[model samples]
Target: MVHIVVLGAGIGGIPMAYEMKDLLGPDDRITVVSNTDHFHFVPSNPWVAVGWRTRDDIMVPLAEPFARKGIAFKSVGCRRVLPQENALDLNDGSRLTYDYLVVATGPELAFDEIEGFAPQSNTISICHVDHAVEAAKRWEEFCRNPGPLIVGAVQGASCFGPAYEFAMIADADLRRRKIRHKVPITFVTSEPYIGHLGLGGVGDTKGLLESAMRERHIKWITNARTDRFEPNAVHATEIGDDGQEKAHHVVESRLTMMLPAFRGIRALQGVEGLVNPRGFVLADKHQRNPTHRNVFGIGVCIAIPPVEKTPVPVGVPKTGYMIETMVTATAHNIRALLDGKEPAEEPTWNALCLADFGDTGVAFVAMPQIPPRNVNWSSHGRWVHLAKVGFERYFLRKVRKGISEPVYERYALKLLGVKRVQEQTRETTNV
Candidate 1:
């Protein structure tokens, strides 16, 4: 009987376990090793930071669900991944061997990359549920005595959506409390523009997002490289297109939240031919590592290069849609290997995201998540906010029920329909 061990229990790991379980034989086993005992919906973290969502609202206990599905669960975490020996050194001082391994251990937050850039320091983060919980506490404190606010992503950060979402959501929250006028918001981002989003401005996102920020009176500094954060201030330099520092500014703020850069977890760092210098797993298109065929990667821990060069470093985002595709491809490919056949399935790698603004939201889809794609679309409306809320509930239910059915394909198909109909109408009218 084959044993498959999946490391991590976040958005990627939990789904990977369920999908693989469906494809494996009855005797074959699946065990999930996680650092945490519960699964939290990560995309809803911005709301958590703003106190719109609590810890219980988005979190699900994993033990019962996994047990019901006959999948072993462990929360002791991993100290190291012994790839050469096909084993893992558990934090509990035990060793677990596997016939196959899936490395879905989402990235470790690289807050130390910047001085005073973590929750314990000058800035707050919503990257983790725990951080979000703390940010919520700080949010209440900030509101009682609000001042200027700062929110954005630091340099080398790949996930830009949540930064934008949190900034807008905070704005919405302040306005509802009638304290928006007392606070000035500055969006500090490494992106070249408000909508660059590390994918080079998907379908007028630049215009749409800039307009949204203008409506909310949220000032932005693009191509900004933060140097340090002191109490009530952030030091940053604005970079020019010529790659020179155009200006240095010390922005005042009573509250700050910035999305930190991500890297592979410590356990996988510096493994020859397995990880890059930044500790991200190196995997082929089929999600299998070439150096270790039995190992696969399926989430933020995998290395994806920048979509394009910018004045400041900005990495491509692996949205939930993209990660789901990776999980599906990896699951099918592993099943193929178990059947004594070469793996053939490859992920589509498309991306779909709804960046809720607390009131209204922006939604976008990139057909391949890289440039030069077939479908690149973005839209903004209150409906996008409603859709995001619906999706959070739908996804949480999927996880709690141990449902392995793929969901993003339906969203992709719907977007495709809208895209084609719009194209045909434009052609018919010669507009």
Candidate 2:
């Protein structure tokens, strides 16, 4: 029996485990290690921060799902990865050896990079369920004493969807509470334009996003780099089109929620040739560590270079569909390796994200996840909002029932109309 160890149990890790089990036989042993035992549907965290969703609504126990699949689950955090020995050192002073290892620990929130930016400061974050709950409390207090509000992403941050969603939700919440006029809401970002979204503009996204903000009366500061945060205001260095920097407005705000930049898992530090300087594991197209073939990585923890350098610098965004693609590829490759066959290379990931506006939503699908894509499509409508909600409901039910499906394949075929094209080609060639 082969021993396979998977680290972390977030959006990336859990699904990868299921895929691996499906490929490997029942006799193989699989273990999942994670710091937390609960998996939070992170996309809905913005709604939780605005009190639209509760902690319980977004969280699900991992033990039940893993148990249903007959996989071993460990709730201990990984302290170090001894890839040379194919062993993992746990925080509890225990070690486990494996034939194959998967690192899906995801990114860490580097809140300490900014001054006066402690988690319990005047600002808040919705990256986790606990943080969202705490932020919701502060939001409620701010509603009673209306003041300026700021929401945006810091420099080098790739996950921009949450920032947009949070800003819109806050705006909606303020209006519902009859305090929209009193609170001045500002959307600040490192992106050069309103809808760059870390992948540059996605087909008319700039105009559409700007229009949405205008309708909501939300002010914006683009090409801005956050320097520090005080209790009442945030200071940023704003760059102009001429490549000159000037002191921007230090807008006063009663509430602020900024998404900090991401970094690799701390456990991966000092692992020679395995991780890049930024701490993300360096993997080939198949998600296997180039230096250590037995070790693999997926999700935000994997290192992917920036498409191009922006004024503020930006990284690639790893959406749910992208992560699942990596997971699927890794699972198949691992199974092949165990069978003494050469593993197949995984394809590069594309990004598909749906940003929820208060009144509606914006949907985008980018091929190759960066610039120079074949199909970069996006649109905004209330139907997108309803579709997002429906997906969330369907996903939760599937997880509860311990069902595993390739979500990316379904979306890719749907969005690109690939099946329709294939059918048309078949008919034409036959005729």
Candidate 3:
């Protein structure tokens, strides 16, 4: 029997385990290890921070679901990965060996990178349930005393969607409280343009996002580098084409929410040849580590080279659909390797993002997940909000039931019209 060990139980890891169980026979062994037993619905974190949702509404335990699928689940944190020996060192001093290993621990927020910005400093984050809860408390306090608001992503940050969502939601919350005018909101980002989004502006993203910000009266500072954060202000710098720079206005923010840059988890850090300089595991097109065939990585834990350069640095964005595609491909390849059959390489992921903008939401699909795409579309309406709510309920149910449905692939191909586009592209190229 082939023994497989998966690290982390986040969105990427849970789906990978279910898919693996479905593909492999009952005789095969699968183990999932993580520090926490509950899996948090990260996309709803913005709503949680705004007090629209609670922790219980967004978290589900992993033990019951894994047990139902016949997979061994451990709540021990990973201390280190000895890939050379095909073993994992746990926090409890026990080493688990495996025929194959999957790393999906996700990204760590580097809050310490900026001055006066630690976990519980002048700023707040909605990256996790605990953080979101704390942020909600701070937000309530801010509501009582409405003032300037600073919300956005910093340099080298890939997850821009949440920043946009949080800003919009905050605006809506203030309006509901009849304090919208009292609170001056500023959308500050490191992107060269308003809608760069770390993908160099998906089709019409620049126009659409800019219009949304304008309509909301949300001021913006583009190509901005946040130097640090004081107690009630954010210090930044903006550069121009002439190689000249100007000191950015110190926006007095009573409440600030900034998404920090991401790095790989500590367990896989410093593993020679296995991870890149940023500590993210480096995998081939098949999601298998180039140096160790038995090792695989998916989702934010994996290293992806930047698609292009911007005035300020940018990293690849890992959307939910993109992560699911990588998980599916990794499971299939791992199964083939265990069976001693040649593995089929998986194609690059296309991104599909549905960002909720309070009263309504915007949906976008980008082929190849970067600029210069073949198909891209965006729309905003109340139905988009309804669709988002339905997705949340359905996803939670699926996770709780341990259902290994191929909902991701079908959703991707259907929504993006990839199959038809690929067929046309092929025919055109051949002619």
Better of 1 and 2 by lDDT: 1
Q: Name model 1 segments beyond 4 Å from true.
A: 411-431
Which candidate comes out best when scored by lDDT?
Answer: 1
CA lDDT of each prediction against the hidden true structure: 0.91, 0.84, 0.84
lDDT score of residue 185 within candidate 1: 97
Say which candidate scores most in TM-score. 1
| Per-candidate alpha-carbon RMSD to the true structure | 2.3, 2.5, 2.1
TM-score of 1: 0.96
Tens digits of lDDT, candidate 2, 35-91: 988888888889999899999998888889899998899998999999998999998
lDDT of 3 by residue, 1-431 (tens): 88999898988889889989998887899999998989989999999999999999989998898999999998988999999999999999999999999999998788878886654888999888899999999899989988999999887888998999999989988899998999989988888888778887776778888888998999998777788998899987875544357556688898899888899888877899899878999999999998988999988989987777666776888888788888888998987887788679594587877788878877777767866776666666766666667677767887899977755556535543556767786798789
Q: Candidate 3: where are CA atoms >4 Å away? A: 241-244, 411-431
As a whole number from 0 to 100, the lDDT of residue 170 in candidate 2 is 85
Of candidate 3, the 10-residue stretch with the lowest lDDT total is 407-416
lDDT value, residue 4 of candidate 1: 99
lDDT of 1: 0.91
